[model samples]
Target chain A: MIEQYLLHLFIIACVYAILAMSLNLAVGFTGLLNLGHVAFYAIGAYTSALLAVGLGVPFWGGMLAGGCMAALFGYLLSFPTVRLKGDYLVLGTLGFTIIVEAVLKNWASLTRGPLGIAGIPKPRLLGLSLSPLPAYALLALAAALLTYWLLSLVVASPFGRTLKAIRDDEVAAGALGKDTFRAKAKALALSAFLAGVAGALYAHYITFIDPSSFSITETILIFSMVLVGGTASLLGSVAGAALLVLLPEPLRFLPIPSDIVGGMRQAIYALLLVLVILKRPQGLLGEDTLRDAWARARRRRKGA
Target chain B: MDILPQLIMNGLIAGSVYALMAAGFSLMYGLQRFMNVAHGATYLVGAFAAYACARLAGMPLALSFAIAVLVATGLGVAINQLVYVPLQRQKEKDRALLLASFGVFLLVEAIILMVFGADVKSFGLPVRKGMDVLGAVVTPVQLVIILAAPLVFLGLWLFLYRTRTGTALRAAADNEAIARTMGVNVRAMTTLTTALGSALAGVAGILVALEQNLEHSMGLPAVLKGLTAAIIGGIGNVPAAILGGYLLGLAENLGIWYLPSGYKDAIAFVILILFLLVRPQGFFGTRRREEAGG
Candidate 1:
């Protein structure tokens, strides 16, 4: 039974790994502060769920379609926010998430409202059913690895350097003849695509989907993962995702009261977020240890 | 029976509360130059503290309110000192400050949920008879709230324009480097701003708790609407912000008459996006501003 449980955990970690890596492409590398990242996940989940249920599409086709749908919205969302920065950008994205949730909740004819969509067929790949516990572990692992490899390639290419350049200094990047808006939009689209794939994987595995599943909590959780693991690092995304997935596991083994467990987990997450932002803004595995910045701070304080 | 009076009365009540929040919000934004979202948590702290004192401890409502304001004020100043001040000292600090503020917000929200279970709470004040005014039944508490907006605006205007300390605070907010060079004690001014702004938030929280059901998740959405009102009036303009609040409250109430109530938050988002896209400076602002974080 523990074997089954651990395998389940691994599969969930795989999905989170995909989500974290994709989010890192936008927030970590490109500095987007996309508070509506969950919108993409919801879009992907619903898109794949609808395709699978309404048309009997296989797992691969449904998942790809989900990713494409999310990517399209991600690219579209980026255009309006290309010029906004800091707090304005945050508000804009937060509004999008609210709008997405509103639509998902009110469009009862399609989404079934709060009752949610159920009876989703388990994932299938190449005519092989991946519904068994151990089989799902391997399938999720393979999917996560494929995502990692492809994103790693994207992060290492000139395009990745351009994203970092734009993050560090957009005006300079634009001066260098790099189309900043287009590049950032493409990066967001790719990130959303991976998130969509993860969402589809989650939906089929859980065999249910709802609007509440893709709330602001998901955004906070994934954002914390990227920050804790190390921003701008692909491996950090995997590590962060795994760490968060495993963090509250010990709660089940403890003797804490059931009612307080959820609150305790949230408290721990929020505490970690504040600590990480305050103590290590570069994150656990991020580059540039801020030595130069500290020296400047010291000199400034000394009235130099 | 005409429904216009009741709707307008409801709009005025909501608008006044939102204006109080926006006044504090704009002050902090001006002083810190970033959205101090943790200010929203002050509402939670104030309302919860008041509820605990008044209902649980059986204290008088006025005394409970005073204690709540003090606690919220202290918390606000503590956040400014412990969290935001450090971030403000760094280069490329705008994003970090905003995120840190959000982190503090979530941290407080989680703690509140833990301490006060996820249940809707109320102060259980004795119900007062409603008086008919222009075919609408208006309660005493509603009248107080409706009057509070203009009173707060007048008080803020007097303090900012007539007092030497207030002028000094404005100078600091306008340009910190210049203010410091002029020996303005910019840090003290910021602390003062936090204290004043948070006290206002505490009052607004108590008003909201009195008129509506109190829940753990109520703070953020209400404050987001306050932020919307602030944006509509232009970020730092006081009179315009108050005007914007009334306008938004009126819009929301009147919009609900035609559409489902579930679309209330959606309406705010639509307005926010439209304003952000078409009129970034808001309706009554002379300054044109945009930043790419460079």
Candidate 2:
């Protein structure tokens, strides 16, 4: 029983790790303070769920469609709003998330209102259903590892350097002849794609999907995971996800009332977020990504 | 009774409350570049404070309102001191400040939920007959709101234009470094700005609670509407924010005439996105130099 519980926790951690890493690309790498990252996650989950449950599509096909749909939305959203800098950009992203949630809740015909879609079929490999906790855990683990590897490669590529440049100073990056807008759009699309995949995995694993699961709180949770783990560090994303996923689990064993537990967990996260941002903005596992980048740029100028 | 007049009156009432919120929000945004997500929490605190004072402590209605505004102002200033000040001192990134504010918002919200349960609370104000205004029925409390909003705006305008502290705040908003060099206490000005802004939010919250009901989750929607109004008016422009608030109120109310009432919440977001994409400088805001990126 203990092992089974551990596996369940592990799967949740893996799902959150993918979310954190995807958010890290926009927030950590590209300097986009996207408060609406979970919108794309919802988009992906709904797309996949509808396709698999309604159209009888395979899991792989649904996942691909989910990623593409979310990416399309990312590109469409970023094309116009990417030029906005700082807090304005943050508001723009936040507006997107609120709209997405409103649509999901109000569009009864499509999302079934608040009732939510259920009985999502499990993933099947070679006509063999991966329904057991252990099999699903392996699937989630593989997806998380793949996401990390792919994201690491992206960050190490020339595109990654350009993103860092833009993050540090968009004007300087522009002066150097980089298409900063296109780069930001691409980054947003890629980030959305990854988040969508994570959403797909979550849908299949949980076997239930609802609009409530993709609220602003979930976005904040993923964001906190990124910040607490260490922005701009793939490993930090994994560790942060694991830590947070496990942090509240021990509280279940406590004699506290179930109703208060949810609020307590959120309070703990809020405290951690405030403390981390104030005391250790570099986070626990990685260097201060944006500040260090700015410092490095300053040092380079001084050297010149 | 003409439905048009009723809708227009209803819209104006809603607009007046949003104007209060937007004006304060715009004032703070003008000075501090970061959006304080905790602004909503402060509003909630104010509403709940009034609720607690009136229902639990059995304070007089007027006294409870005053106490609520004071508490909100204190909470706002405290948040700035505890969260934003330390990060500013460290020269932390804007994202950090934003995240910290979000954290504070969540923390305060959870605390409010814990203390006041998740159930919605009401002020239990005594019911009175609705007065007819221009062929439309208006509640006494709503008339008070309508009358009070303009008075508050005028008071704020006079304070900003005629008072010494207000001038210092304007100076800081124009250029913080220059304001500091010119003997303006930048720190004190920020604290004052937060207090005033939060007090406005508090008033808006109380008025809203008196009109409707109070829920812990009301903060986010209130903040969003205020934000939409501020952005539509042009960020940092007080007069424009007020105008935007009225405009948003009208648009939202009239919009439900054509579409489902459920889409009422979405109208603000749509307007926000449209403004962000088409004219981010908004109705009165000058195009910022930084926005002109390559």
- Strongest candidate by TM-score: 2
Cα shift from native, residue A47, model 1 (Å): 1.4
lDDT for each residue of candidate 2 in A1-304, tens digit (9 for 90 to 100): 9999999999999999999999999988888888878999999999999999999998999999999999999999896678787777878888889889889988999988788999999989987889899999999999999999999999999999999899988889999999999999999999999999988999988889988999888889999999998888889889899988988888889897765777888888889888988988878776566667799999999999
Tell me the lDDT of model 1 at A144.
Answer: 95
lDDT (10s digit) by residue, model 1, range B1-294: 899889988888888888888888878877888878887899888888889888889999899999999999999999998988878766658877887777788778877887887878877878899988778898888887887768878888899889999999989987889998998998899999999889888888888888777887777886788888888888877677778888888888888898788787788888888887777677885554554222
What's the CA error at residue A282 for candidate 2, in Å?
1.3
Cα lDDT tens digits for candidate 2, B98-197? 8898899999888888788788888888888999989889999999999999999999999999999999999999899999999999888988899999
Mark the regions of model 1 whose C-alpha exceeds 4 Å error after superposition.
Answer: A257-259, A289-304, B288-294
What value does DockQ give for candidate 2?
0.62
For each candidate, report its DockQ versus the true two-chain complex: 0.52, 0.62
Best of the candidates, DockQ: 2
TM-score of every candidate? 0.94, 0.95
lDDT value, residue B8 of candidate 1: 87
Rate residue B56 of model 1 by lDDT: 87
The docking category that best describes candidate 2 is: medium
